[model samples]
Target chain A: MTVQQNVAQATPTINLPTINLQGNHACALGAVAAGCRFYAGYPITPSSEVAERLAKELPKVGGVFLQMEDEIASIAATLGASMGGVKAMTATSGPGFSLKQENLGYGMKAEIPCVVVNVMRGGPSTGMPTRPAQGDLMQARWGTHGDHPVVALTPGSVEEIYQQTARAFALSEKLRIPVIVLFDESLGHLEETITLPDVTEYENTIRKWATGKPEDYKPYKADADGVPPMARPGDGYRVHTTGLIVAEGGFPTQKADVVAPVMKRLLDKIEINNDLVESFEDIDCQDAEVVVVALGIVGRSAKKAVRELRQQGIKAGLFRPITLWPFPTKSFRALTKKAKYFVVAEMNAGQLILEIGAAKVDKQSVSGLNRYDGEPISPSLIKQAVKEVLGHE
Target chain B: MTTSNKKNLEMRFSGAGGQGLQLCAKIFSKALIGEGYHVSMSQSYEPTSRGGLSRADIVASGDTPDYPLTTELDVLLILDQAAVNASEGIIRDDATVIIDPRRTKNPPQGNFKVIALPLSETAIKLGSERITNVVATGVIAALSHDIPLDIVEGALKSISPKKFLALNMDALHAGVELARGLKTA
Candidate 1:
């Protein structure tokens, strides 16, 4: 890593307000700031600290925290609590994320507004408990069975963890679907400075539970936004929860007509609002010949690597997806005219590259720069990758 | 190195895992932030407890960083022998490495100047088994030549528990003397 060769003391200013913070604390502060009132999760590495912090901190803010027996039960409890009329969340890593998949599908099926925080560990199955991995990009998007709505946000920094975890909850409640805050194990365990925001700058989502006239209220009845009017259990409303297709009353029904609109509402909310759902970062690609697409810790490396390449006057730029699941296709795809070559760098064997490939039409120019040994891709390695794939190496 | 009236400075405490590196990083960063430096400290370590490497890159810069990536090393404090090898390759040539000479297997060899302080052994001399980091922080503060004595003292003041305050203060000052005694060879 040639420090003097690149990145002179430029863009000097207050960087972001340094405050020593552990990643777990960042997760807690993010969720709390984002309007999370309920947390239900089991303890696990890189992720346990999140739960541990929330256990100690949530009660002070009038929020409820529960330690469930297992990951499945933890998510289920969070789902139930969210529907009971408050913003809810759960945190976990690899094996636990796998356990929560069926229930995650249940969240989509039942349209429960809750946040699931998956601090990814290296895995096929419990591969590395503490090291980071961007391996769960596909899983966060399609881990659950069937067609389901998703709102997944990834934070590259500790500050982003605080900001995005809050956004995750707001997104879940606003869209009335399960939202996932995805951070690699690296980001989860890494500590850094985090500022507790001025409270007023952030907006939080407050779940509106059914009040008055339970008889007329339909739990699944769609409003103008296509989200069902949700009310909690014991709210004197006939609120029923289902994993099966059901009518607005919350009862399971075999009627095909009932299933279509339910599925439609589930999918449409995310689809119609795709523009609002995806988040990204773009640097110096205005007229670049090559664009490097990466996220998480790799995104940080890519940024430094691009800075190096640019110093050599190689016209390199970085495009990081803040929202990994929905894959910011619109923002990235729009740059095809200016970006003739796209180097997709990730810590996986082309998981995110597959999405980038699908989102591009110029197949010849779209290629992958991948690594999956759980070690982070360095700037030098990425620079070499950028040069090799684009014929500069 | 010259200061232009800036009261805050962020430095990174790096070493391999389980040498109490995270605790060391946290104590310093927390101490700095407590002294109002707006500190950002983070550690990245391999998952395993034994033989796995651990690194804490605690940044206590005066200005906040947009991202928590630290490239500038004012003082690179190291404990593990492997850490000396790792830091030697990457850290800035101008940066100072405060080493516990007793622990280093392959001491940094180059034109680079090193302030060798037996911080850990000194902590052992102070009757506690785990104040080498505190003593090292003192050494780093003294050798920093860039940071002020009051700021380092204030950081130590902010972090030490009330009962052990005087002892730590002595250890810290001891490190300063040790740093002053080192001659560039």
Candidate 2:
């Protein structure tokens, strides 16, 4: 907080081309760039900067920013705003992320498009507010109850945080599902200099609004893509949304036939379009015999380890999934074709590694290098893991 | 682990909380990035509002930094004895150590290059001890060509408040002069 502000220059649009910024600030600015017009959240450590920055910047762009009483109301307000035809978002850390789960399921069930940025910290319950952890990886995918699909993106750097936030918005809007931008405490607080590309560099997607006659519109009706065209309230079209099973006419239905397709479409919207939602980074992986699978800040360290192993004449590589959910199983399977050994490095106790093993990538060859401590996984530890997995000289 | 062939400079600025160590690291990092280098900074602080240990580790390189954390420190600037103790086993043999001799009565015996500067006293002489971090940052800019003094001045000008701009600039110049006067031998 003692860091002085930049000189009194006119506050340009939050999307400045070049700046030194924290990862949390980058998410807020990226939200603005992606045409996000509403933000609602209860402040929490590591993730609070996004809410704090958006509270100030959103108003300047003719948007709405609200500080809700709790994480529950925060996500509820975000869902409400998104239903009202605006790109909306809410951010919170571990405990708050847990509190928002029920509403997150509500957003998913109702097919509301919004973003939830979870800056992760150590937690079973208020464990370590200031330290970094990937404890929420599995929680993010399965936190909310029931069977529903969601997209979650993990960023390793401030610049990637910015771009991934914009992508989260685009994906959420396109898929009509709440997208989670996962951030570890280390990444959320990291400060770095980066050059943001021009707005033309990334495409932005907005939800399709019903263009049919008001009387002919069905709020829950699906188009060819299996996503319903949304019509905001007061738009002369029926706009009923509920957590209960809903019919295509936007009315609650008890019939099994009506409820089954509705639930099916909710999952199909993301699962069927998995190719569009999945994103992963392959570093020195083409000819690698040893592959280290990592995510978020741990992935950055894995990249360094891979570079070091390569210098030692060991064919090591890094597989980092930018999108955590949907698990990017196809990419891991692709790597298994060439890899002789797999070293899974994560800040959690074998969360994503289990998923890699679930992909059937030779369980005998996959080694779990787990860390649940509050500290980050160092590149040296990862290199040591690689050496152990490969039994190299 | 085998090290890479990349030549990158890694530095840490440590002090008790409220010493403005994070701000000093940020100013130096921004200046290096302005000179067209890739820079990443990571800082760890006490969970409380203030008064515990605070440190900011920075990695700056011509190429993008693959590992953003300070795996090995090339230079360390400590403001107090606690910082000196905190850095006991981490300081590399060839690294440079710049310390304020008033707070740290005895510098550690090591193969690293050590330069003693009374940064707090110098800042107090200029106007206030709050600018000691700025004074230390000035010494860092002068010690290496990686961060030019002009760029640091420019960075400080933009980030420092108008109320302390003059004093902070003076503190920075004083730091540069202090470092310039020192001889390695």
Candidate 3:
């Protein structure tokens, strides 16, 4: 059968009801709230609920949901759907995430805006299908193999996943890049009560479509803000997108002068507007002698540890980076200067600590509490890390 | 995490699969949430979960819980000996332990306040063997006082599938009555 037959046919609309949901389901509904009309994914554990829910629900919104043969094709079809003018997304776990990296890079280089949800599971290669881990921190940034900006957001609670997934779409569309929403299996399988936000709460952001005559269009042209307005394939605008470095006209170019501007614009779109993408939560850092840096579910445990330490009259704080890719360097640098030491706690051996050390000048000032045995980093472990960092009980 | 008399409660419900332990956990969690408590519930099944070990836990508190996983279980509700073994290292010394005496003839040794009831036998006598979990939840709600029986009933009314709603409610009420008798028994 031809690939054309693989596309899903639209079905009748169904009511979107508010209910207590798992983080994976919340991610699917959140994407729908953010105007995702196309979902192409291959089911992977812990992340499978996202694909399963979208398959049944997308058609209700007059959207298309396609289950591809594999992870590579899943992302490819998603990119194709996005280029066809629909807001698209795909969800996967670690193994599938690794498969999608090449295309993730293609989506970045081609400036196709999309959202990729990684419901994180343990390990190198399908290590633990049902276990939770935050080992993909560096992989999300450097996984695609080259210097490219990545916008990765992690949500600790189910309710926060809804908000963050929607925000991921907004940031992807506004910046014309792929945004990754990381939810560990711990959060993905977690079921909790959440009050669904009204439509007004989540602000939607759509890319500026190219205007004027088709002949005047420069598909790779950068606006003053370094983001070029996008045009769909059938929108009467001649758009050329490729994995190769190209000029303003979107055709491949080998000349350094032409390549320099395109490369610079791609990086500048995110780095120059870093303020718009940087987000973090600071807890009790003012009087803290030691600050614990963490993200994902570890961040939640860290917050609890910080509060418990405070009750014991130990000055401890939590610095949680909601946006993982850009690193939240400037704000964390300022926050670090006030604290005597930093403790980086995550499920992986030590991924985010490198960034924490890089953000602050001294490497010795930062320590790491790592767990890779397939369990979440507990609060007491973080409390111990804090005590060790402070060299006190 | 609260410093008041209103404190967080850590609970675990474990049984052989097909006893509806997952639904029991859900009903209890929803009841607590309805009463304005933040509850995080997680369930895990062994590789042989269909006929083997199935366990669910809930962390309920007036304040939002930072860690969803239960560390030191304040209450342990076991329907079989496997559950007692599963909960060996987790229960606090002062924890309130509830078990199905039919399955656990001789209870494990602990410094806990033990409430041994015929959970499965009671449900089987009520004309259904599928609702031992709901009955156990009723006993739990009554004993813990963190979630009210009426609230759990309301949660059941909303969440339980219509066909089995009546049977589940009956089992739940039977459990509530059983736990109430323990007050005087």
Per DockQ, the best of the predicted structures is: 2
Candidate 2: regions farther than 4 A off: A1-16, A198-203, A254-257, B1-7, B84-90, B105-110, B125-127
What ranking emerges by TM-score with the best candidate at the front?
Answer: 2, 3, 1
Q: For residues B41-76, what per-residue lDDT tens digits would candidate 3 score against the true structure?
A: 876665343666668888877665777777889988
Give the TM-score of each candidate.
Answer: 0.87, 0.91, 0.90
lDDT (10s digit) by residue, model 2, range A234-313: 77886777898888898888898877888888788877777778888887665778888898899889988888888888
Candidate 3: clashing pairs of residues = none
Clashing pairs in 2: none
Interface RMSD of each: 3.2, 1.0, 1.8
Q: Where is the poorest 10-residue window by lDDT in model 2 chain A?
A: A1-10
**Per-residue lDDT of candidate 3, residues A184-252 (tens digit):** 988998876666654332344688899989999999888887899998676799877789998899789
Give the backbone clash total of model 3. 0
Worst 10 residues of 1 chain A by lDDT: A1-10
Return the DockQ of model 3.
0.48
**Index of the highest-lDDT prediction:** 2
Ranking by DockQ: 2, 3, 1
Q: Candidate 2: TM-score?
A: 0.91
